[model samples]
Target: MHIGITGASGFLAQQIVRDALAHGHRVIPFSRRKGEPVTGCEPVRTFGPDIDLSGIEAIIHLAGESVLGLWTKQKRERILRSRIDGTRWIVDAIGKAPSRPSVLVSASGAAIYGNRGEETITESSATTSVGFLAEVANVWEAEGQKAEAAGTRYIPVRISLVFGKNGGAIPLIKNIFKSGLGGKLGSGKQWMSWIHLADIAALFLHALETESVHGPVNGASPNPIRNEEFTKVMGEILKRPTLFAAPEFALRLLPANEASLLLDSLRLIPEKAVQTGFSFRFPELRAALSDVLA
Candidate 1:
């Protein structure tokens, strides 16, 4: 398969590109800058509708602004605009392409479910949760859905907290725990859904290859852990004490209440992936953490 990947420089995208190449598939990375190139792949530098995608079999759209910092007004706008505009550009490019890609594996977030305490979220779950992130996700997915109108299979992967070595959230969390300052956020009772970086990257390939999978797929493990349990596991893995806790009020007082990203409970399950016979290599948190830390 010839795959066209946007945001090829991103951590997740780089993994996907590597996996795709390893599986004997051709990868063409699309970047906004001309000089930037992804290793071992031909980089196409363009972002507008006129971008050439003729002969690209599938596209894994992952370009977007990072949402890690304090959610200031400008930061929130950038997050939303990047996804919305980026998806729009890709969809438009698909429409204009002489030969459109068959499948579009776009990136969404599990935050679309919001703070659903104890409720297990699946692809069928209604996205009624209201928040800045939720709104961004809803809009982002909606934009990606436009490709369906152009006779493309649009699969929006609703990603969870990604755990990986050297990238994603794990490295920072590891440092905090190593310093013995890591602890549960708020009451630590909130459910946290996570996926190993390898599993998430593989799931994208699964979606690209599987014909039965469609629409929004939850990119999370079957076993979701509570915040306290996650903290405990981190402490054990890092051999550090988790004796601190950040109260909810204190978190909310932070700029733009970015604490919601930490405190929001999303018990996500990969129902569609499982039903379609996709398997996760690191389904358990402890094992996943061990492999990542090692």
Candidate 2:
């Protein structure tokens, strides 16, 4: 299977490229910046003729801006436009090709189910949060919906916090831990759906091959760990005492929109992925943290 990715340079997309290539799938990586190997896969600037249709099995759409930045009007526009416009371009290109890819594994986020407190969320869960993130995610998924209507085998993967040694949010978290500053955020009881980086990469491969998974799929582990639990476990692993806690008022200095990501509660479940006969590589939070943080 030949796979092409939009945001090949991203942390998650880079992992997908490596996983696909290792599985003997030909990968045509597309990124804004060219002439670089994103996770061992050489990335090209343009989505070329070679990637239009023939022999292309799957397309992983992960290109988007980091939503953690200060949501200035322009920055927020970039965050939304880059995804919506980029996806629209890809959808247009896919529509023009004689033969479209069998499956389009488009990227979304679990933020769509925003701040659901202690209630466990599934793929069918309703998004009631009026936060900026939920709104962003709503529009992001709509961009993929256009592809699905075009007769493309579209699947919007709503990913959670993917933890790996490098890249993703884990590196920053680890750095804070190494400095002996690891502790709870706000109340620290917020639920965060985390998956080991390896599991996320594996899930993409699994989705590409499996025909049964077509719509929205959750890219997460079965176990959703809480903020306080994660901080406590991480502190224990790093052999550091988590005595200092970041107050919500102090956290507002970084970025306002990002606070929602850091402090909110979301008990997400990977119901669709687990039901597809796909086994989790690291099902427990401790096992996942140990591997990535080791």
Candidate 3:
């Protein structure tokens, strides 16, 4: 398979590319830069609607502005526009392609479910969650769905909190716990759905290869943990004391209600993946953390 990946240099994209290459697939990395090389892949300069994707067999759209910083008005606008516009461009490119790719594995987020408390979130769950991140995810997935009109299988992977060694949120969380400043947010009862970097990468490949797997696939482990339990495991792994906690009021004081990202409870279930015979290497949080921290 010849795969075209947007945001190919990103943390998660890099892992996916490595896995794809290991599986004997040709990777074409789409980049905004004219001649920047993506290691071990064919690099293409993509800018605006005129972009060409002639022979690309599949596309993994992962380009977007990071949602980690303080959500000022400008930051919020950037986050929304980057996803909406970037997805729109990809759909347009697919429409114009001489031969449209068989599948499009675009990135979505578990935040689309919003603060669902203890409700088990699956691909079939209602996306009635209302908030900035939720809205972004909803619109982002909708835009990617447009590719289906061009005769492509569009699978929007609604990703959870990704745990990895070198990148994603784990490094920062590990650092905080190592410094003994780590603790649960709010009441610590909120659910957190997470996936190891390797598992998520493999899930993308599974979705790409499996024809029956369509629509929104939850990129999370079968076992979702509470915030308190996650904190406890992190402390145990790092041999640090998690004695502090970030209260709701203090978190809400941050710009643009960034507290929701931490406090929102989503007990996600990868029902589609499991039903389709996909296996997870690290289904438990403790084992996943041990491998990542090691």
Candidate 4:
């Protein structure tokens, strides 16, 4: 199968592209910039609707600005525009292509079900939280729905926090723990829905190949842990003490209430993925951490 991917340089995209190549699939990376190479994949520089996607069997749209920075008004706009406009661009490009890809697997987030304290959320859960990210996710998914006009099967992946070595949130947390500054954030009672980077990549592949798995699929593990339990597990794996707590007030000062990433409780469940027969390689937090840190 020939696959087209955006955000080819992102941490998750790198792993997904590598896996796609190993499985005898051709990966053509689509980027906004020109002349940049993606190691083993074909890099196609495209702007707006001019993207050439002929002969592409599928597309994994991952282009977006990182949401980790301070949530200034400008930064928030960039984040919103990148996903909403970026997805619109991809959909428009697909509409104009000679042959539409069979599947469009676009990125979404669990944050859409904002701040559901202790509630287990599935793809069917309604959006209850009000914030920037919640609004962004709603818009992102809405834009992805446009791809269906071209008769393409659209699948929106509501991804959770992906943990792995050298990237994502794990390394930063590991560093904090290694420095003995790691502990539960705020009250540490919020539920955290997370997935191993390996499992998230695998879920992407599953969505790409499984025709029956359409619509919104939660990219998370079956096991969702509380913040305090998460701290304990990380501490146990690293054999370090987790005594320092990140007060909520300190995090609010960061961009987008950067602290919300730590304080908000989301008990997300991947019911669709499980019913679709997708198995997670690291469903347990301790094992997931050990593999990432190893």
For all candidates in order, the CA lDDT equals 0.90, 0.81, 0.91, 0.88
Model 1 global lDDT (CA atoms, 0 to 1): 0.90
Lowest lDDT 10-residue stretch of candidate 2 = 47-56
lDDT of 2: 0.81
Candidate with top lDDT is 3
The CA-based lDDT of model 3 is what? 0.91
- 154, model 1: CA deviation in Å? 0.3
Error of 3 at 278 (Å): 0.7
lDDT, candidate 1, 156-268, per-residue tens: 99999999997889888888888889999999999999999999999999999998888999999999999999999989988889999988999888787577898998899
Per-residue lDDT tens digits for candidate 4, residues 52-109, read 7788989998889888756788988899998988888888878988878989998888
lDDT of 3 by residue, 134-248 (tens): 9999999889999999999999999999999998888888889999899988999999999999999999999998999989999999999999999999999899999999988
Instruction: Compose the digit string of candidate 2's lDDT tens values, residues 24-65.
Output: 887878876666665555446564333344455578888888
Candidate 2 regions off by >4 Å? Answer: 37-55, 252-254
Clash count of each predicted structure: 0, 0, 0, 3
TM-score of each predicted structure versus truth: 0.97, 0.92, 0.97, 0.95
Q: How high is the lDDT of residue 21 in model 1?
A: 95
